[model samples]
Target: MIFLNVALKNIYMFQDAKLDLSYPRKLPSSTVENEWLEDFPKINFKRVLILSGANASGKTVFGKVLCIINNYIAGSSINQSTSWLDIKKVMFDKKKPTSFKVEFLTPKTAQAHKLAVIFDQDGLIEESYTCIDLQRNEPQSAMYKRLREFEPTSYYHKTKNNHDITNAGFTSVAVSQGKMKVPSMWNYRLCEVDNTSGSQGRITAHDTNIIKTFLSAFDSSITKVKSIAAESYKIEFSNGEHVLIDKGKLLDPDRLSRGTHEAIDIAMFYEAMKNESFGESATFYLDEMLAYSHTEAEQSILNLLIDTLPRHSQLFYSTHNYDILDMNLPVHSHVFLKKDKYSEFIQPEKMGYNQNDRSLLGYVKNDVFGTLPSMDAINNL
Candidate 1:
């Protein structure tokens, strides 16, 4: 099954995983509702913010909060879709009514909007609820019912579920259908280059062009993979042609490493984001942004996304690999999560750092953040 615009958009390697039962699922929905927002972190987010924390820290939880809020405002939701089953793996569940409240300022929407969602043991007890913190406004009210119904095809409203979006804004919500539909242009384009005899001539002329475009987003030269279908995927350039190796034979993608499977998947996902127009306002929350890349290629994948994705879109992703934090990224880009003595997932900000001195990587290295264990600790254990 395909999932559209539900999690992350554009980048393929960083897409969220579809739950297949083998993955450890979280508590039942009823237990999710008892938790409440103790407080909101006071931080000015960038066009892109990375919520980095320990294993159980609220990084994924914050991402869910944003997702629920966005889907509510855009009239596009994934509540009815099983594609979000992976979200259970990402979010923190206390087996109680859990509430999330966030005050955010979108680039277009200037008003301070308060959005909240409460998930209890009874199954999504509260969907995202929005509120406008206007001085003249009275008590909280439902915003979804008052929205302009911008996307009639959106499945969010089709479901009989009720979400609270009293203070939610326009750019805050979007919908995610279970399956994805690739645009005809991309399909035709890929097919055109499907079968040619030469290294470059075998596929459609656009084949190399597509690969070039895909690689241009990164800071490094194109990654050299022997075959898109193999474990040691390498690239060999000769006579103005790229050859993928399979069983020691110099051939095109039809014969290569298993990485080819990943390549095709990436190509399809990229087409979805490039062809779709969600206007300029969109935010994607991917549970794991590096699902297909090799350990060394993960950073390159992220760099490509950071380069190709338009500034209008915001992304939030989670990963167990400390390699993602290898570089000295900005402090604000991360939100360190750790379980406090109370066994609740809490952000480093809530734990009483100066905020200015709070470093997610540092907290993680020192083991002061999030409920989950650290990579070093995990490895050493």
Candidate 2:
């Protein structure tokens, strides 16, 4: 999705804005709420934020929350809808209905608030959120329209009074599924772009740029040059190897056996981030960013992202891989996640550890984040 469609003003619109697979140069010492200030580090970034957590540690939930906030700020009515009234029941709906709320930021126009889509476990959503001014607790219309513009039309088209897709406020914002969320055409589009240079109607031009830019960062041993004809994609290799995969094969771009191809894709993503012009104060998040690379290659990509990208873009990521951790990137960048018996996920900072400590992962493995059984219980036998 494009935000405030001001032509590259929002970095979150780019796929490369996914995640920065590096260590944090700095961490937020604390977070403040309701006149109480905690020692949370104030996180600042010229690049994207990276997040780490184990399965069900709530990392993805956190990302969705941020996107929801972004949408609320952009303006989409997601809170006033009736779908959230019976949250637990609807969330567990075997054939549940998705719940969404859209609130106009201002009563006079559609630009003051944002939209929220909450997914309930069994089926659709159970709760929705719309911006309630932090201070006034009221909605704004103009803001809602601004944020609405970034969401996919399919999401809002089902709602009443939201058919307008050309409003300037609606056109400026953009949002997409996080790295884990896949679109059907994702793979085909990658193969097509791998064979072609420009996006030119095949897909979003910026997305196409991101693909080419990411691929060029790999070692020359891997070649991504391709030719497109008859609505098909052809990927060529420098070693005289050729494989024609389906368009949808794009879902797992890094699943290929060759490290070079995986490296090339990761590099391309990094290059896109490095070369991005996403002005100041934009945010991006990618989930499980290290799936495709060797530790060394992941490290190379991280270095470029941290050192090379413009300081305007902020990034975040979620991953369970420790290869990224052992890379000696930085301590503050690492956020550990673990789950409790209650099925609740916790972060290192939440469990009373100095988030800035390099030993964070060590503690996580030892059940510091609640992943380990009690020592007494284990030794009882």
Q: How do the predictions measure up, each by TM-score?
A: 0.46, 0.47
* CA RMSD per model (angstroms): 14.1, 12.4
1-381 per-residue lDDT for model 1 (tens digits): 001112221111212221110001112331112111112122123333344545444444445444443444444332434533122233334353444433333333322333334443333443342323222222112222222222222222213543443322222222223121211110111111121111111121123344434443321334443335532234533333455434323346543344443444344334333433433334444444444456566566555545544434444555566666554443334443443432232334334542443335565666655344546765888
Encode model 2's per-residue lDDT on 1-381: one tens digit a residue. Answer: 112111110112111122212122233442111111011122122233345655555565445434433433333322323422122332223343333333322211212233434332322222222332222322223323444565433343323433354221221122321211111110110211222111211322223334444444444433654535332334555777655434423334443455445544444445444433333224455555556556665666666655644333345556566666555443444555343432232334334554443555576566555554345765887
lDDT of each: 0.35, 0.37
Error of 2 at 120 (Å): 10
lDDT of predicted model 1: 0.35
TM-score of 2: 0.47
